[model samples]
Target chain A: MVEQHIASAFDRDLEAIQAQIMKMGGLVEAAIMDAARALETRDEELAQQVRQGDKAIDGLEELINEEAARVIAIRAPAAVDLRLVLSVMKISGNLERIGDYAKNIAKRTAVLAQGPNVSESAAAMRRMAREVELMLKDALDSYIQRDVELAQDVIARDRDVDQMYNALFREFLTFMMEDPRNITPCMHLHFIAKNVERMGDHVTSIAEQVVYLVTGDKPEDDRQKADTTSSVPQEV
Target chain B: MVEQHIASAFDRDLEAIQAQIMKMGGLVEAAIMDAARALETRDEELAQQVRQGDKAIDGLEELINEEAARVIAIRAPAAVDLRLVLSVMKISGNLERIGDYAKNIAKRTAVLAQGPNVSESAAAMRRMAREVELMLKDALDSYIQRDVELAQDVIARDRDVDQMYNALFREFLTFMMEDPRNITPCMHLHFIAKNVERMGDHVTSIAEQVVYLVTGDKPEDDRQKADTTSSVPQEV
Candidate 1:
């Protein structure tokens, strides 16, 4: 009976922290979506909301870390249980980074507002950001359900984001080559594109962590990178 | 006496991981320097070496992680010891990221090789890389010695790196505006500079981890950002 009591208590503690992680992930997903929407629609207010929302995301990361630390201190969990807590911490850290990139996009959205409209580039970025946000959602679901297939699916989707980024990168180069006046706004748009692409990378990392949490080992195959094109100008 | 023996065993386990963390840090520092040197001197061989050295850095992260995991499983460490182990893992993650950024710089150096030589900008980026490498070394030292002052110093230096990046961002814009031919190489150099600045951010994060490990509390003040200036063209 005593052993059962301790096990239940620890399980409860783990569940509580897991709930907070999902909450943090939800906020991050919203931030990504909202940042993309603001960029696509040029909605300053929505961009501002994304920026303001990051404080909450940052707060959740701190709370999750504290809760995980508390669990380690008190529960002294064994191997799998400990990996659960550690992976939560790692996932939350990655979520916080994704949130920061979203905020970066929002910030650039405001600046790009002052310059000429790169509507086509904004549309491409919005698509990439949407893909990342969905991947993050699936990654969280995989964690909650211990579904390795879902996690693997999220990992596979990162390649699509990379291909989108490369296409947009080439397009931006062409825009700059044609018109020097397109330089500044194109630069801002490119940075936002890179930020979204990086956010996708972090989401992939979180998905990999989920697979590790379930399987007790990292994935055998390394992450496949589809980004071979360089910053080199294809035509001068 | 029996309890003390177990405690000493945990300490030795931690010491072993800490040593590996420092070793990873050293390799990362070397990668940063060599990448910068390769850029400045246009030495393809040295740049390629930096790329190859990343494998060793990645291997160390895996080793440090496995050792830390072994200790946590066997020892079930208490609050302080557990925090020490977790912090080492975090430090190693940050070190690996720094190594990756160095690899990115090296990769870009190769791309820039095929384009025109931007010696002035390479010199500037080299300076930024040097600052980040020094900060990373001190961060590792602070972790070993538990020196809060040194860690804080490292954190403070990140602003200078940001300023350098902003300066380069502007210079790259000017170059692109002056001659269309400079566009491709300047873009690559700017990306390399951004990567070095990001490496400094990771180094600062490692410093923050050291402060938390020693003081048992994260630094209350958030990291200051000095990279407010954007790639926006001035006065059109």
Candidate 2:
């Protein structure tokens, strides 16, 4: 009876921290959508909301860290339990970075609001952001379900985001070469695109952690990346 | 007597893992300096060595991780012990990333080898890389000694690296504008300098982890970063 009671209490602590992480993920997911929508529609108010809202995400990270630390201190969990706590902390850190990237996209979107709308390319970026947002959702779901396949699926989607980013990189270069006026705005847009690409990487990492948790092995070496920036398409 | 023996065994485990982290740090430091020297001297052979040497650094990370997992599993460490294990894992991850950045710098230097010499900026970049190498050294020392102030000092040095990068950014822009022929090489140099700047960031992150491990508190809000790429300095 004593052993069973101690086990239950320890589990309750893990459940509570996991709940915190899910809550944090919800906020990050919302930020991703909001940032992308603001970019797509040039919504300054929405962009402002994302920038202001990141503080709450940052605050949740501190809380999750504290809870995880406290659980480690008091529970003195064995290998499996320690892995759970450590991974939750790591996933939360990744979510926080993803949120920062969302905020960065919003900042650039605001800069882009005043200038000409690179509407065609902006829409392409929006699609890229959507793909990453879905990946994050799947990554969090896999964590909750302990579903390795779902996590692997999320990891694989990252390549699509990378390909989209490379396409956008080529397009941006052409835009700048076509018009000197496009240089400043296109640079801003390119940086924003790069941030979105980086967010995909963090989500992929989160998924990789999920795989590591479910199975003792890391994800098979990620597919050879195709996002080499220097390999610009031929200018006929 | 039994309790004392267990405690000493735990200390041995901790010491063993710390030794591994220190060994990894040594390799990363050498990689950083070698990458910079290759860039300065335009030595493709030395660049190749940095690239090849990174595989050993990656191998060390896997070993450190496996050891950490084994300790957590078998020893069932208490909260303080768990913190030490987790922080060591985080430091190893940082060092791995620093190695990757060094390899990236080396790759770019190899590309620049075929182009006209941008010797002036390459020299400046070497100095910038030196600052980051020193910062990484201090960060690792602080980790080993558990010195929060030294860790904080390492964090502060990142701004200097960022400033150097911004100055180089301006210079690269000027070079490209002055001569269309200079565009390709300057772009390569710019990317290399950006890689060095990012290495400083990873070092800062490692120092932040050290501060957290020692004080149980992350460094209070890092000084506001001033590396806004658009803030091109106006000549007086």
Candidate 3:
């Protein structure tokens, strides 16, 4: 009976840790969205808010890692439990990195806000940002619900973001070519697209972590071996 | 007497592993060069050489990891010793990834070879490839020699590569604008520049690994607080 109580308490602690991870994910997703919105609307203050939240993301990453260490030392989790802690560590790291990239985009947004006539370029970027935001939300949802199918959807959706990014890259390049005066803003747009593409990669990484958490196996092999002829799909 | 024998044998094994790492670095560097050369010269045979060498690089990475695991299990190394083994594992992973990226470039070269004329676009890509090859060489040199100065040079030189990439990106944009027919080749050029940039990043990761190996502390604080500018320098 005492042992059951002890195990229950440890499980509760792990649940708390998981909840914190979800909270951090929510914060990061909001930061990504705000940064994107800031870029779209040229809202310098919102961009600054996203930039400032980076420290909080970093703090949460370190905090979760420390908690995980403590749990491992005390509970000595095995198999699935071991996988869960490891996934959390890696997932949180990826999330923190996503936060960093979002901060970078926000910084670039702040710079762009200082300029004029960003609406056209910003609209194109908004399309990319909205898709990436959706992926991030779904990936975290997959994690929270332990839904492998949702995670698979996130993985499949990454190629769409990749294709969108390629198209946007060409569009930005056209803007730069049309006028060298647009170089600075084009560079900022390029960075935004790059960050969003990386955000997709991070979301894919998170989805991979979810698979490991649920299945105890890596799914990378299947994806890596995908046919080379298959171009990433396009969406309206 | 028995303890002394075991200690001497362990030290000998450790030295052997170190030698193997250096040798693996040489192989990786060669692969990067050959892959890039194959692209520049359109030498399908050299590209084939890189393809054939992929197995060797994969084997080396596995060997390094296995040896590190064995050492950790048998010797129970702590502190700097622990850091050294960990560094070995990470550096080996970095080298393996470098090899994969090199292989990717080689494969792209194969595709480009299938095309006629290949254009000045290919030339631009070749230049980026050469820069990446140089960075790979310098990074590994720093790792093998433990020359922080060499690593610092690499860190600094990465910026030059970045600026060149940005310039090339601008140039490619113009090419694509002049003719949308040029988009595919331009896409290839962009991939080359990106691969080069990532090669620099891997080298820096190696540099960081070396620092951790020698210092037993990751330079995380330096990274987070220091110049968060473009990862590479911005010199042409």
- Candidate ranking under lDDT, highest first, comes to 1, 2, 3
Tens-digit per-residue lDDT, A116-139, candidate 2: 765388889889999999999999
Q: With candidate 1 superimposed using the best TM-score fit, by how many Å does residue A112's alpha carbon deviate from the native?
A: 1.1
- The candidate that wins on lDDT is 1
TM-scores, each model vs. reference:
0.95, 0.89, 0.72
Q: Pick the candidate with the highest TM-score.
A: 1
In order, candidate lDDTs are 0.86, 0.83, 0.73
- Chain A TM-score across all models, in listed order: 0.96, 0.95, 0.90
Superposed on the true interface residues, model 3 gives a C-alpha RMSD in angstroms of 7.9
Q: Which residue ranges in model 1 land beyond 4 Å of their true spot?
A: A231-236, B231-236
- Please list the residue runs of candidate 2 whose C-alpha ends up more than 4 Å from where it truly belongs after superposition: A114-119, A230-236, B75-80, B179-187, B230-236
lDDT of 3 by residue, A1-236 (tens): 98888778778878988888988998898988898899888898998899889888988987897686566555655556655765787788789889988998988776677666633767777887788889989999999899999999999998888878777776765665565555446655776787888788889989988887788676653265222311321111
**In terms of docking quality, how is candidate 2 classified?**
acceptable
Global lDDT for candidate 3?
0.73
Better of 1 and 2 by DockQ: 1
Q: What is the lDDT of candidate 2?
A: 0.83
Top candidate, metric DockQ: 1
